[model samples]
Target: MIAEATEMLLSHLVLFVLVLTRLSTLLMAMPAVGVGVPKRVRALLAITLSVLLLPTISNDLTSSTLPQIDNLIELLVAVAREALVGMLIGTVVQLLITGMQLAGELISSTGGMQLGDALDPTTRANMPALARMIGMLVTTVFIGLGGHRYMLAALMDSFQTMAPGNVILHQGMMDLVLHELSVGMSAGIRLAAPVLTALLLTNLVTGFISRTLPGLNVLAIGLNINAMAMLAVTAMAIGGASWIFSAELDVVFERIARLW
Candidate 1:
């Protein structure tokens, strides 16, 4: 009877570990729940959530049904797989901001602001102020869209539809993720398009001013106009694009779970 009881305990352990791994992975990588928060806090949150979820999950679906040693190995693999998926999702979200950052850099370069650089508090990386602005703006919209809640819902549903023990990720999932990458890059370029267009126009107008009016300081005027134009465009875009962009934030996160 003692040996049987020990076996039952081991089975439950395996299942709990599998779910714990999934929860931990999501917490570690998902926005708001991931890096922005402290590690200890996140762990505590994961634990609370896991306990709440454990009762609802069946023994057959968890470590509770497995023998002790088998449960341990399965639990390890299950947690690691969940972590891999969480990391993948998290990386996609991070790249979206990086895309915006790159666009800002391009705009800066064109506006003759290539020498400028600064530290970004959120990313703890050296980034131009313009890039930081663009990245921060998008991140704000992501939060405003309730992206964190949506991510959790998607995660919970994913377990229901696809059990943790299966450990199977279809190839089509990569293709879908790639599609998100394309969408993110496209959005970044679109946000910076006006600035880029205005910059090009500035160069044209400045060249003509320099050629036609040699006495004027074309570079100085060009610098001021470039700065003013970028500011104006960003301000205008932010006003209208905030809602549209925020909607996409939810879509991007959902793609991970909903897509093939």
Candidate 2:
């Protein structure tokens, strides 16, 4: 009886470690939860989530379902597989934010906002003010729209469908990632289109004015005009930007669901 109990405890412990590995990787890859969060806090959250998810995961981990991990090397391999699965899911969700940041970069360049670059805490790099603002706005909107919850739901679903240690690294997965990346790039361009158009027109008019009044300091004036135009157009198009981001997010989540 004691031997049986010992075996059971070991099995449960292994399961817990696997669960914790996946959750830790997921959180680390996640944008809002991972970036800027302290290690201690993230670790605590991972532990708590692993504990909460263990019971459900236990039901799915029968002898037939669980991978054979006879030794430490095999266990490590299983853990690595689980980590990959978690990273894939988190990366899929992160693509939306990446697209939005791309839009910000375009807008900032067009509007000459690159001079106002600031240190982005999340990325630990210098980014244009507009790019940072747009990134934060999209992140706020994502959280406000319950995107994090949907993300968690998808993670939970992955466990049931993909199952830990059962990850199949295939060409299809690579294709899916490439397709999502292209979609994100196109979405970013589309999001910046209105602002780009407005900025283009503003520059043209500024150029014409400079030609008409060569004595005027048109360089300085044109800069101010471009800034104002960008701000105005962005304000007018903020709603549409949010709508596009939300739609893209839905598409990303749907693709993630189909991965299993």
- What is the clash count for each candidate, in the order shown? 7, 0
Least accurate 10 contiguous residues by lDDT in model 2: 163-172
User: Tens-digit lDDT track for model 2 on 62-134?
Assistant: 7777654679998888899888778877776677677777888999888888788898876788888777777
What does candidate 1's lDDT look like per residue over 89-126, in tens digits?
66667666666566777777777776677987657778
Task: For each candidate, give its TM-score against the true structure.
Answer: 0.85, 0.93
Model 1: residue 233 alpha-carbon error in angstroms: 2.0
In model 1, where do residues sit more than 4 Å from their true spots?
59-75, 121-124
Poorest 10 consecutive residues of model 1 by lDDT?
A: 59-68
Every model: Cα RMSD to truth: 2.9, 1.6
